[model samples]
Target: MISVFPEVSSQYLIGGEWKTSSKIKEVRNPAKITEFVGEVALCSETDVTQAVDAAENAFKAWSRTSVDERAKRMKEAAEKLSTVIEEHVSLFVRENGKTMVEAKKDLLRCVEVMSKGADTLLEWWKPVHVEGQAQKVQIRKRPRGVTAVISPWNSPMILTFKRAIPAILAGNTVVIKPATYCPLTVMSCLKIIESSFPPGVINIVTGSGSVVGEALCGDTRVRTIAFTGSTETGKKIMSLSSNSVKKLYMELGGNDPALILPDADLNEAAIKRIRLGILRASGQVCSAIKRVYVHESRYEEFVDKLKKEFERVVVGSGIQPDTTMGPLNNRSQFNFVKELLERSKQIGAQVESIGQKLDSASWEEGYFMLPSIVTNLSHDSELVRAEQFGPIIPVIPFADLDEAIEMANDTEFGLRASVWTSNETAAIDIADRLEAGAVFHNNHTVFQNLRLDFPGIKESGLSQETRWGGLELFTDCYGFAD
Candidate 1:
């Protein structure tokens, strides 16, 4: 039996204080529907304006601080994050419903991303000079005024740090609006930085997207918007910001594909990549492998091996140490996955479930769905074309390499793609041809490095998020001559 903890009310962290409003929204634990994690303060337009005003006021002092000073504060925040790692990880699991192991890894990744931002600050401050015949010219990057950061619920803590840390490190004050479904972890992160940062450097507001997001985007005080969510929503954000033409950075949806070639290692390659792409975050990840195109020669064997691997996953409450998977974040997502699964079946795709279902008598309260695999899908089927964002992998077989690449690039979304092959030269050739922001060879798209550029191409997104590229995203160029 899982023990329930006392319910805690969540509040907005604005100007370094926890403020509450009369309106509140209930936050539920997706693993056990009986448990209420807490309620978040439903912020009003006044709340959003206050948060933005705080950020705008702090911009002067924060943007004037030396890069080294900002880097030091960021490093301190990262260290503080490490000290409370276990607490945050436990909270993430309870609130977001990822397994304990997955939660810990996500926290660790947040720490790493924070530290990377600190390192980037130091590197970005390096002096640059250009020699000229008559005079010496120098170029430097300066912080943009105020930034509005909007993150999604899939991995709230990590994405929050990914956007906020870099923006702050680059000398920009931020107003963060984390996803309503998972705001506690982000608030906790804000508390850590609040202790180190000034009162108005990092301001957080919690509310429905319709109310708060529109206010932030519509406000003229905001200079830039960094967002991560669905493509349709991104379009709406773009429309909202058009009045002021605020600079935008968006990482949207992906229908990532992993192609299995005839020369690939049948056992190690297929199982490893599939686990990372399909099983991680229970397939809530934007880069999760939604479709797999296998060479006709090894299609059956690959499917059998993948099914066996999928069977080994233990799904239950996230706190269980042995749990390899957990429930989806909320009922809406649960219903979305179920509806998609049913739609795939109706479209003539073969669906298979692995492992034993936990007793519904006790576990039925939660929004749980078994990890599923759909096979024999047509190249143009909805399951293959759409972004399911669930733990369901659709396997499609192709006769030739050209057909496989064509099918991989068939989707309207092109966030990421991968190829599993032993031939290094052939893999490189295929990687160049694939339409994605990032490509993996002998691996899946889940693998990301801080040094490389991270962004989607075409409809996927418009900006990159690591190294110097990320720092420049929050900066504006100025020129002066005398």
Candidate 2:
């Protein structure tokens, strides 16, 4: 079947040029299973070395450039990105399996992060002047040389730019290894950047993570490794990176919780946030609201309201204008979600279908699944404790604020949380006590501020993004005393 969107060129960008090889991987549209969108070259170990060498050579000159110069280059790249918004968004929808609306938003977020680097870096770059006895001390920020960034398949473009933009603004050369499944979007973004920056400043390679990722992290010249993916893989990268003691920034998995208090506005606050949590990006977000702890007094009402609202979501191909949710990125993801739903059923969780299934005629071949809500599950159930990266949410009942807070903090992953309550003081009080790195009071946990720092506390990974603090992740701190 011919795809609604035409097949576009898909190739790797290394040292300011597009590359193709005899070995290419076909990229399929998740919404149209038979459609082949394009093909990407599978980088071998030699390609990985070449990309790394380009970045290494670029760092010598690029890292020495004034911060102002680097900022100018980044701002230009951001403006160039704006011109390709439609094209970039189209690629995101086709390659990453996100709805067109969501893709646009993600592209805009990437621009926001890149364009605001000047202001973001200024705060961290401020010279620390210390008046000491008989001498003066001033501390300055320095680049960490070449940085290797390995991004995941979900939200590929946004996460890739998140790490790359900051690293570049801090005057560090970056070598990107994007997930093979969604390298097209990142390659498109990199093409725009390559046109603006000098050769070797920014390079991209496409290949399996195990082969390409290990070589990049294990390279002695690569000074830092910023990764975003599964916790198990993150641990392996950490072990491999120990040889060089490369500076590391890991953003792993998350199992966020949303607590609904008895006094909360179920209609406005609770329902709206819950819908965003599980429904946004088809529930593929790391900080997605996977579990909900509702006050027993309002449990039934919350569940009913959520079901009605979830039913209103429209699922279709990401390129369609009316699509609010898209198919899972691939078959593995679809099966993983299906397995989780089945497990919930076996555990005696009350399973309820909330959204309409995709049209059997057009979408039958795609990796699609229905939106689901499970209730009456104990807090200790795996459904409640584990991260469900799908359109499934489990609702657990709590008797009081103490119990709600306890349940919210019970997980080993402390990435994000949300609390909904009518009382402003009570909401803020509870927000302060939540164990997660970020807490949303009377709102959902999906909101991310580009100027504010965003990261997790525990297993959710190390480091943050959006602010000057993130810029420091690509820099090395040095001390000098005389």
lDDT of each: 0.82, 0.80
Q: What is the lDDT of residue 176 in candidate 1?
A: 91
TM-score of 1: 0.95
- Across residues 401-472, which tens digit of lDDT does each residue of candidate 2 receive? 888788888877888888887888887788788888788776665446665555687777887654463787
For model 1, how does the per-residue alpha-carbon lDDT over 90-197 read when each residue is reduced to its tens digit? Answer: 777888999888888878888887787788778876756656636655667798889999999988887777778778888999999988887877777667667888
Instruction: Identify the leading candidate in terms of lDDT.
Output: 1
For each of the candidates, the C-alpha root-mean-square deviation to the true structure, in angstroms, is: 2.3, 2.4
What TM-score does model 2 achieve against the real structure? 0.94
User: How many backbone clashes does every candidate have?
Assistant: 0, 0
